[model samples]
Target: MVEAVFQILRAGKSLELIMSSYELLNEIEKRFPRIYVSESSGNGSPELVVIEEAWLPFMVSLDVMSSEKETNRRKLRGLFDPNGFHELITGLAEMAYKTNSQRLDTKVCVFIPLSLTLQPASKTTLLQFLGNMLLFQYLVNVLEGDFLARISMYKESMNWNFLRECLINMLLASKRVNYRVLMKECLHTICGLYQDYAGIRNEPDSSDEHSSENHNTDVAIALLEVQRTTCMAMQKLIIMIMEIDMSKQQANMLGLTTRSDGLRIPLIEIILDELTYYRKILPRFLQIFNDPKWKLEIIVQYLLKYTAKPVRTRRSNGPSEDSTFLGVLKSFSDSSSAYMSLTSQQQLPGMPGCNEAVIDSLSLVEISKNVAAAFNSLREADKKIQISSLGKEALFTATMIISTS
Candidate 1:
């Protein structure tokens, strides 16, 4: 029966063929589950007993392609309608969770296409792949009494429910000692897919229709699109973080493994390291944006979120933080003697935690000329790109302006 399922899946192309194969597997699963009634134990009583994981080997072989570029091999895409895929994943999750099967993730992760791991991922594939993983994660989480209701409350979109929540939940669950490595591998694989997708978008396409210079602009636009997708997803997750009012629990996801709540925050270093690679490629990617100022401003806005608690600044009789920041940097650079003093002090020499703001009586940004001049000075001296002038100034100015009012 398993051999028949694999053969049908490998050769299946039409929706009818795929659904037939799905039905076959469903029937087989029904007949011989992880725990099933056995023949009578000679005393006319039926035996109900646990069995070895007999389903995993067939699932592992349910590849879209048995070999590379196999003409007959195709994805189960047509069969992956909302209800059908959900049923399939739920079955697999239940079976694997029950038997505690080894390499079960490998079996499940194969549901994501091998093409996703390649370059130039389509939006269709990405969402479908994400949907499938979340489905599997939901099934597993459903068994945990703690997560059951929250998992149920998360509404489904695109036939996949709260992706941000599910992804984080799965990662948090994986952090457990038993499932850690398997879960990590699955995450690393998914990240690798996106990296490939992003990497492909960052490159200039050699198009016959466009000149070489124009092609660079095209690549920049494409890179921006890819960046937007990732950044939007991140923003959604951040909003989800803010929404979580975890006022109670024996522990509100801040557990023994690490002080960091894996559920609340993603592996940021992993993400940032990938972004650093994106940053290295960004200079080329930024060559031909229509609104260069807005591009620079947006990037600065994202990176400026380092301030843990935003504080309003009281009036200072002395020079503003923005004006003094460069002096502090200069002194720190020219004098190795100030290194310890600079870092040790709660405040840096000339710069305050809150920066300086120049505002109108009406509290409007009416200091364009002065601001531009200051910006130029900062830009010229900030060759190392150690800090963003706009970010620092905005932080300082906004806080102070609010305080003064």
Candidate 2:
């Protein structure tokens, strides 16, 4: 019955049916959670109880993904395995990228092969897009529910096992998924959809042949709402994964993790790597990934990577002594001779002999200017993003140095 409703929602044949099925699935999840806590009789503590046999929206294991019968069942039931989820996110990312490039044409139907045989290629394309959006939203909803339950249990029990077995963790841990690519695609999808939907809402509709169809209009209206929610869901998923990484690190520090658990690179590192390579998306990503703690950390780390002096020893695991945001900003106010001595030894990648040129180009003034620009971008991205006292001090210091420079 759950699978049937999921299929109906994925089919997206009727908006009414889509809403009803979507709501029904959510209600079902709420009433019958797969993970919860039961009060213990002995110590008055809450015991985590995972219903192993309970139905899940994901198929994370390799055996289940490999089996012919299981594969056929997934196809029939619209279940999302890791590979399928990756494909879904990839598709959304591509669609969003195209839209961002202003190459998405509603008049020309780009058909995605699906079971639904809706008439008119354009309508079919729209419906397929809507279906994918709805599907992603539902999956995020499931992940959120499961994660919240597990994290709650972990808080009470301090048991890393419960979180390690979470659906989001398992989904990302699967060998079939490229964790970095998945995160990059997710970042792209969030930024693209955010811009695309905002433009759609702000711009006036240009009348076209398709605009006359009330059915198409209705789908467009629904699509707008779903896409907005989908953008939020993408952000939520990224933030949740970051939360999981933090929790995992905590567990590792406590010696609760094992080798069998395998190693996954922290999501923050991946995000930082992506932003460094694709600086064009940095502002958008910072704007969207608006968790105050992580956001400040990312910004500080990003600045430190360029400004801080290189470490001489591989044994040192901590950040450089001068890596703090305030220190980096203060470095901008130092004498040119002192600043040059501080950063002249560091070499930019692919430019071994140009350390002086690199330092000259990326001068303290230039760094301070960019720092102020980044803060402005953050404020522009989110008017309500809370700047911590440290953040305010850093910003003030950057702007003051910039003015002096």
Candidate 3:
């Protein structure tokens, strides 16, 4: 029944059918959850109960993927295998990029060829795009439901197995999925949609040649709402993956993770690498990837990559005081002595001391400028962002340093 509803959304036959099926699927999932907590008969304690036979939107298991017939059946039934999931996000990312670049008409049908279409191409395109958006939205909803239930159980049991076996983990672990490419696509899709809806990028031009103005206006409004929600759903998916990574790290620390848990690059590191390579997305990513703890950590790490010394002693287990945000702010002092204090050990032979001093001064100036720009970006991205105590101190330090400089 759920798969039938999903098929309706995938078919993109009509707006009314898509909306109704989407709502019905969500309601059904809510009422018949696959995982939940139930009280144990013996100890009156709550135990995590997973209905093994319950329907899931994902078909990520190796056994299922290994059988061609079974995989085909699942695909026919509208289940998202890992490969299909990656392809879906990848397609969305491409669509978003094209839309942002003004190369792709958002109201033109992407799935159906114009020559073979029975209906008006523009209207078909609009409905198809809306369907894809809702499809991704629903998938994210399912993932969130499943992950949150597992996380709740994990908190009580400290069981790595529960998370290790989650649909998301299983999906990412599949050999058919290119984890890095998938993650990069997700980041692209989120930032592209965010830029479009946030007015940073121009809206796509409307096509009235193939559809009526009234129809276009209605589709435009619907697209706007669904696009915003789709962006939020993408953000939620990223955060959930990061949460799972954090839990896996905790499990490893406790020696609860075994070889069967398998190894995967942490999502935070993947995001950081992507942001580093695609510098244009860094500010937007920092703004929208708003899990405060992770956001702060990413910002600090990003700064340290540019400002900190190239190497640290083996005995140093963590970033030293000089490598911290406060330390970076302090380095912005106008005094050459303050600058020299941070880099004196790296002085080279055959280089004049004055030349070295000039280079270090320029470096300090650049770092300070970057720090200021990053803070400004954060503020621009979110006007209501609350600065923590440490953030406030760092801000104050930067202010004083700027005044003096």
**C-alpha TM-score for every candidate:** 0.28, 0.74, 0.74
Best by lDDT: 2
Clashes of 3: 1
Q: Give one clash count per candidate, in the order shown.
A: 1, 0, 1
Question: Which pairs of residues have clashing backbones in candidate 2?
Answer: none
For residues 1-405, write the lDDT of model 3, one tens digit per residue.
Answer: 777777888895778888888889889889998887888999998888888898888887743445688767877888888888998998788767765222223342223233334544476676777788889999998888889878888888999888988888888888888888899899999987777666522544456664453454555556667778899899899888888988998899999999877798877777766876789998677666767666765665555444434345788796344444544444433234234433454422111011223334555445555456555555554567676775677666766666677
Residue 21 lDDT in model 3? Answer: 89
Full-model lDDT for every candidate = 0.34, 0.71, 0.70
What does candidate 1's lDDT look like per residue over 1-405, in tens digits? 565564554355443454465456546655655444445668764444444546332112222224644322333322222233334434323322222111111111112233334443343433333333333332222223222223333321121222222333433333222333332333233344344444445455434444333413332333334333433333333223222322111134333223333333333222323434445433332332224433433333223222112233675455532322333322333323233322342321211221223221222333333343443444454444454574577546755654565
* Candidate 2 least-lDDT 10 residues: 347-356
Q: Where is model 2 more than 4 Å wrong at Cα?
A: 62-67, 100-121, 205-215, 310-321, 332-405
How well does candidate 2 match the true structure in TM-score terms? Answer: 0.74
Ten residues in a row with the worst lDDT in model 1? 100-109
lDDT of 3 at 173: 82
Q: Candidate 3, which segments miss by more than 4 Å at Cα?
A: 63-66, 100-121, 200-212, 310-405
Q: Relative to the unseen true structure, what is the Cα RMSD of model 1? A: 17.6
